[model samples]
Target: MGTNICVTFFAFLCLIALSNAQTQFLRWCVISEAEQKKCQDLKKVAASMYANRVPSYEVIPLIECVLGKDVYNCMEKIQDNDADIMALDTGQAYFGGRYYNMMPFLAEKYSPGGAGTGTGDGMNYYAVIVAKRGSQFNVFQLQDKRACFPGVGTAAGWLYPIGEFVKKNGQTNIMQVTECNAIVKTATNFFKSMCLPGALTSFYNPFGNNPARICELCSGFLEKKCSTDDPFAGYDGAFKCMSEDAGDVAFLRHDTVAQMAMNSSYMPDNYELLCPNGMRVPVTDYMTCNYGSIPANTVMTSSLKTKPEVDVYKNFLLKAAQWFGPSGQYRNQFDMFSSQPWGYFNRRNLLFTDSTQTLVDVGEKNTYYSWVDNDFYQIMEYHNACPLITARLCVISKQEKKKCEKMMMAFNAKDLRPSLDCIKGKGTDDCMKLISKGDADMVMLDPGDVYLAGKKYGLEPFVVEDYGNMNASVHVVAVARKRDHYMTLFNLKKKRACLPGIGRGDGWIIPMNIFIETEQFIPQHCTLFENLGQLFIHSCIPGAMDKDYNPNQKPVSLCEGCAAGGFRKCQRTSEDQYFSSSGAFRCLTEKGGDIAFVKHLTVRGNTDGRRQSYWARNRRSDDYELMCKDGRRTHIDDWENCHLGQIPASAMVTAKYKSEQDRTIFWQLLNYGQQFFSSDIEGDFHLFDSGTWYNDLIFSDDAVRLMRLDKSMQDYRNYLGQDFINKVENLHKYTCVPVKPSKKSSSSHTSISLLLLAAIFILQLVV
Candidate 1:
């Protein structure tokens, strides 16, 4: 019995020892040989403290070092479970968390007096521009000046300070600088020379296109130049560049100058902070004279760790700080805050920033997006902007222009590319002219205008609007009141008709082509307004009086049924009560027209309480009927078989000279815009909804989505189909006429002709 008890106790003791060893094991990733040496020494110091029963050392974990090629490699190792922890700058921490699924648990804090004193909030530091006290220039004069930066992608060194410069120089469109190399190009264009460490390495300058002047002020030689190994590569290096007169200004953290001055001959009073307003103040007033604040470096670990596991890591860091920090009793044996003793004299920050005093819990701001300031994160996003071209969209009316501008701002805010620009024109024809002249890029047009644009101005359709069905066409129907039995497709002469507009596909072109094909109406002259005037006793053809579409004799009957009071009469806009498919239906319902020409959805959209206009109140879809081409009347829902013609839907048209790539880019722009700003989204702007007053602004309000057309359907004729094109061509052959010159051009021509006649008469008299 005595032997059994002794053996059981020994087994229990061995199990306890094994459990402790397993629970205390921690592997830390290091990026440099110096960091690895420092990490090993830290392991020895931690073991010694625990064995000696140093105060608050019970939580210390057994440390092991893992070497990595760089911070990115370290992040990958931690994610893959090959390592457990690493210290990273806030910018690098963001990359790790966003790309490697790591999380930050602790942040480094600095003291106001200098490093090694543990005081400030430990969450944020200010970015500032430092220069000699009596420098002759201000912030605005930094163009073509020598500058120094810690390294590429560092918050205080590149993002915050460069963001301020971009703002001050009115580079709001700098979102166009989408890549790291593009950002370097922008910097090169603005600065005469710079010392941007790590800017020319294979990681940042993969194409070997970065300018050499970006590294002219760096102190490293040969392959180490402009790399992290460069002696001038951190906060201290940037300051040294300025102190040695290698650069006119240095971008650094607000605490950098004060911290480095503690051991050097440089005094804080010799330098001043350059305020964004172009004023200079003493470096001590950084709070009032800095560009912006960014988060500090953080100690990060894999996000897959459990809460208890994370707690263990946090507690270990806290205990290590208590024992090895500046005020610790073991400070002389192993100072965790200094790297000079570890043979890293040329490189300042190893394992941690030399300015870090102690580690603090990150608390609830543990995620990368939450831990970093939103503005600073957005600045970083600019470096990854999509490489896309910019395209201009044309708008005709003031309301459409406002909506287009809002869309541009919203798309830019989301960083969607290709970026959009809004160009305002007087009318649809003007927009077409603008696009043809290359002043604008694209516009939305109905089938009638699409044909005109293609046949007259050399434009093609690249994208088509989809209205929920695979068929990219709508039924053009002649709608009439069920009580009006006399209004058939074979209507007698001297009847009134309402048309959406002069050039609209469903409202005017299709209906007029049907009339000509059936021989119900005869064209006495090439002038459509006169022929239509003689056929119908009175008509509501909106835009009939507009000189751009007519430019002929004034027809009183065309505008007689229009409801607008003044100059807005017969205008092709929302101001005219009779201007679109819905407006034409309203004209037939209340404006004393016998027949209404519109698309199939006009009745369903405005009737049944779908529309809230006062004119459409108490209207029901059952009250309307469709006029079929076979001289038969049917219910409104029978438009699929009882319509005059089916025409293609509206499309986005651009100059035919635009390459396939250009067309694809335009399609992508609209496709992306609708994804975020579509009617289904709760965003502030709706891409498909026109306000209460307008029917369709830049695009059709009924469209649910935009789709890119197949390569074979890029041409307008092929997209509209040969049969529809033939019908339209037949109608246009009799109605279309050469546009007369404007009055000013005619007068100029007359004056030139008179001058030539007088010159000839004088020559004849001399002979």
Candidate 2:
């Protein structure tokens, strides 16, 4: 009985060990038995490559039966966690990411002929429109002209070029009229004859349910319709279609003609390229003639994996690429990417790009949309029958009315909505008023005005514009020249200072709030403006330069440090040496003041004369340093770990009284506009116009995203204190203000603030 029990225990132990082994190695899915055998063979190759060191990878084949045309099914397997990775065509990659919720992390980089493949410059190839050299026609003359496409849904061959044609013809709204039928109907009507592989197949077109003529132009053999297996189906096939005089023009990848010219049957000199701008060039000059670059295909993954699991998989693939590159010693021993091992693969080349290139993380899910051009995705949206949402943006303009209209024209050209509509405002303040009063939907405001609008004008900040490398909240720093010795906010006491304006957040409110919070001084401590002058030895306040601009309506000692009797003295104009952040930093740099309380970026922008202004262009960055909290000075980049508190960025404000739906739609509208126009490709639509007469448009030029202003903004407001906020709002001195809180109450407040901040961080993580 004891011997039998020992045997049973040993068997159970073996089962557990096998299960653990299965979990350790990656499960690479192979489509057929033959491919499965090849996968096993490659494992030996992988082992050989890493023979000199400990192998960082182990892959086991998971066999499944699937057809080449049914690549989408394999993607579904990845989504369902039945498979781990696969190499898909670019179109399949898009569909998987968009609909099936899969991730594409690596793309194949192929070598052309014998030399290295692709430009090896991190750039993808382009789709070219090719026609016979003698054919006298541009892209626009394709009305009833014969057309040939390599395949349906191929990025370079069909989508990019067709998308360009549709946009030029103003059929961007074609999706609303017809679904997938939009492309079919448009192409069929525009072209006289065509040979589009897969257009009639169920993979692309409906099986016998759609119109009969959809496949009429296709040259298929007895009952074998539009299969990629057909010789006349890919780039070579499309070229053949044109060369045989069966089609007048062909839409294929840029290198197709050059590649085919190597064949005895084809001549490169016979073809020319149709440029999108109604021009023509020889086929060999396709680099300049072709459409914009398309993204390469990727080996995708599902979002279900943990970070460690994802990292392991990514590392293994990267190791494989490095091991198999041309210069690697293992290159002669094995061709891991070759098609001979994988029977049902799409192309007769390696699984990865010809030569091993870098593997980029495209992220999981629909985030892959950025890889595809905004124009192409918009076209895909139309073709896929997705609703196009347009929101109208209210432009707050004063004198640049025509320029606002021109900006709108540029925006519409890129098709961002709600399209901006200019609503003339008397000034910046008036624009905020218009938005609050429901006369306009939204307006961008400076930090100070945003605070004012939110507290008193019934408007709430939804999005904050990003500037430079900083986050939505900027630091309100106290700047001092390197020669000065200062430590902490306390050192600023009784020092000559420069402020951009009395009403500006960075210049006044934030600094004053810090002073009050630190208990160094109180507003009640000074009854007259004379107290402010006493607080500082002398000060330059630009807003108070004009007698009517001060909130207290008393110029008093605020203008004592003005730029002498010149018009620039204490003036709010750009010509004023201390009018803005740059100006205030200049005031400190030029020795106008012992210290300058300006935005964090101000010191960095003007140091060493990086400024565009004539006065600041020669300043040296090394001449100044930031004062830290521990009474030590450090380099400017170290401000995060030391120095003044951060303030919120400029915000896009809207009436707080609006319906939830209205507010939600307004936020969505702005977010959409930012997403499309923020990319380098959309430079034509300058959402933040640097060249305009106005310094900034609705957003800052460096703005990346518009995040919801949740607790961080509230923290900043809380730091300012309700009493100080009210004092600013009433524009008057306070007689009876609540005394500073007891230590116990302050501790309770601190605990509560920490909890709220933790909650906000958790919420962001969840999102």
Pick the TM-score winner.
1
**Model 2: per-residue Cα lDDT at residue 487:** 41
Candidate 1: list runs displaced more than 4 Å.
1-294, 297-389, 612-618, 739-767
Residue 218 alpha-carbon offset, candidate 2, angstroms: 17
Clashes of 1: 1
Superposed on all Cα atoms, the candidates' RMSDs to the truth, in angstroms, are 13.7, 21.4
lDDT of 1 by residue, 52-82 (tens): 4534424446678999866677888999999
Candidate 2 residue-wise lDDT, 180-261, digit = tens: 2336655776667677766664435432344555455556675544555444566666777788887888887776776665
The runs of at least 3 residues in candidate 2 whose Cα sits more than 4 Å from the true structure, single-residue gaps closed, are 1-415, 421-428, 467-471, 486-494, 517-522, 525-528, 545-551, 560-577, 608-613, 628-632, 657-767
List lDDT for all candidates, in order: 0.77, 0.59
Best by lDDT: 1
